[model samples]
Target: MKELDCLFVYPGAPAGKKNLLPIMPAGLLAMAAYLERNSVSAAIISLPSALDGEFDLPGIIRERRVKLVCIPAHWHRQAGGALRLAEQLKRAVPGVRIALGGYTASRFAAEILKEHPAVDFVVRGDGELPLLKLLGSLGTGGRSLGRVPNLAWRGKEGVTLNRTSYAAGSATLTGLGLAGLRFVLNRRLTPRRGICFEDGMFTYVQARGCADNCSACGGGRDAQRRMCGRRGVALKSPASVVRDFAELAAMGIKEIQLPLNPLPSDAYYIALLKLLMKKKLRPVLKIELCGLPSGKLLKWLGRALGPESKITIFAGSGSEKIRRLNRGRFYTNAGLMAALRLASRLGVKAWTAFTTGLPFETRRDFLATAALVRRMRREFKIGRSGVYVFSLEPGSPLFEDPEKYGVTLRRRTLKDFLAQRGKYDMGYSTACFTEREIVRNLKFLEKTAR
Candidate 1:
């Protein structure tokens, strides 16, 4: 076999830890594709898939002669798994270079490099260009590491952070081949399936970065600015997105999820919907709405996507006051119910989600959320509805300025996050709610779910 220049590994949570689902981000595949397009040999392996008896990871690494390995600690949940994998790979392969990237990694780049000796570098932000430059330097013995933008590396002096100079734009995102799954080495493994795949659905990214600055979302606008130097949402062209959808449909993907609202303006979403309509590709479409869509937009969605298409509304809290505080875009329960009514009339199933442990939520506030969920179940074409306890995200507003939100941070550093390996842990607390209170409320709210 020929030598591989780079291999991207997606880490799952450590054993007994219930963090995120075992799926890798769609963007990671795009990064791999970007490297391949640039004449670099790259492939992806899901750590969960490897551990599921799909293949021997170390043997494959040896066979491919992979020179560099990249792992993403995109979610704080993956912190333990990513670092553990890096350390294990170091012991198993002896000489392979390891790098970590993504939101969580970028936020704690210095700490990771300072503590984890196995991680040779942390590609802090928008990784494509930085990773390309890092690989180039590595091929020449890593003497030019300082020139790589958006990178953190240990030097003779100490840890060095290069300028975060590369923020990907629409053109860059359009060319990434985001739906390219052929590069995943263990794509066939069933036990390691992502949440979407488990539900017989696949996710397609139409944009990078988010416009909203939701208090709990690490991928929100301010978080993007802080982590990736991204100024605004970078959308894939409508034509590009339509083409990717067609490709996914061709690959027998029966349902596709556009994970977020994909917005800077609704015109962008409308244009993509029109393009998909023109293509007449009728894969079951699912979208997450950061805010309630207009009735016209709902009607258009019904026309464009046909039946079995769905939309999820993230009503973070049921109490209008609490919801307004936590969300960037505010909508009243009356407005949400109206939107749900419109969606149901248009034959589009709507799913609503709520979080129980937001900053100012009280027991009464949680009951309001529960009441909303019960009302949604009884009065709407709700495909699913549930309330979950919130986990603090590393780059979110609440995480960055906990004092401002009246939140007390529990896991503030890389080591602090990595210590929760054996069980589920919510990462923060508020004056009104203890972690125990949060869990109790979550259970109570869930009982109201259908």
Candidate 2:
């Protein structure tokens, strides 16, 4: 076999620890496909999955003569593992270059490059173009590193950050190969939550950027603007989305998840559903709703996906006042109940998730969330529901300005985030609740929810 030009490594928890969630970012697969299309040999390896199988990482790198290794620090949870793996790789394969990317990495690119000597580069936001350019430069001895847009590299004096100018558009999204199943199928990769490997579930991203500015979200509209220079949502055409679905179905993907709600208008989803109906592609569809969906949209979704389809709603808080304070799309409990009722009537399974430790949530507010969960259980046949603690995300409004939201930051720097390795720490405490109180409330909510 020919030597790989670059290898993409998806980091998990630190050594001697198990990751709570072990799913790789879907964007990494798409970026790998893009590299392959551009005549760059690239493959993805989930580090934890490989380690679990006792796969020889150093031996494989040496055998393959891999030139570059890319790791994604997209989620803050992966920070510790990513840096640990990079150091291990640097020790094992001394000549190989390491690069990190994703939302978390982009936000702290300069800091990562300055502090982590093992990481040779950090590709900031929308890595397809910047990564391709970086690879080309590396092939030519990295003399042109300064020219790569949205990149931060370790220079002789210090870390050098290039221009933040590459936000992927609809055309780029449409042309690139989004599914890279060939590389992942052989590995012992774990399935995402509520999905089994036998189910053949895959997440398909139909757009770049976000329309909402949820305060706690790292991928909100404001975060995108600051990190990726994205001014608005960039969406793939409905026809293009239909083509991707057909391709996935042809490859035996039984379930497809549109993880982000279509932005700008409901027309995008409606058009896509119409095309899917026309093509007679009936894969189990999962749509994640940022806010409550209208009855008309729910009806269209049911008609398009039939009874097996599902929708996951992120209802941050049950109390409308706390939700409003959180600064996401404002929708009342009445609105959410109405949507749930409509979904139940249409035979569409709905999974609603609430957060227990929001910024302004007091004991009463949390109890309200717990009560709402109980209410949901009594009134509706929800597929699944849970209340999770809200972790402070990097690049979020709360993280950037903790005082504004009455939040006290526990993990502010990259090193601080790396310390939370095998734990589910909230990483911040609100004015109303300490970390202990938050955990206690979470336990109460968990028991009540069940």
Model 1 segments more than 4 A misplaced:
16-19, 50-54, 187-198, 262-264, 381-384, 421-424
Model 1 lDDT, residue 319, Cα: 97
TM-score of 1: 0.94
Instruction: Write the residue-wise lDDT of candidate 1 on 1-52 in tens digits.
Output: 8888899888778756664656677767778888888898898887665645
Q: What pairs collide in candidate 1?
A: none
Q: Give the TM-score of candidate 2.
A: 0.92
Cα-based lDDT for every prediction:
0.81, 0.80
Candidate 2 lDDT, tens digit per residue, 255-300?
Answer: 8878767373667777888888899987798888887777777888
- Clash total of candidate 2: 0
Clashes of each: 0, 0
Q: Model 2 misses residue 188 by how many Å?
A: 6.1
Model 2 C-alpha RMSD vs. true structure (Å) is 2.6
Alpha-carbon runs more than 4 Å astray in model 2: 51-55, 183-200, 262-264, 381-384, 421-423
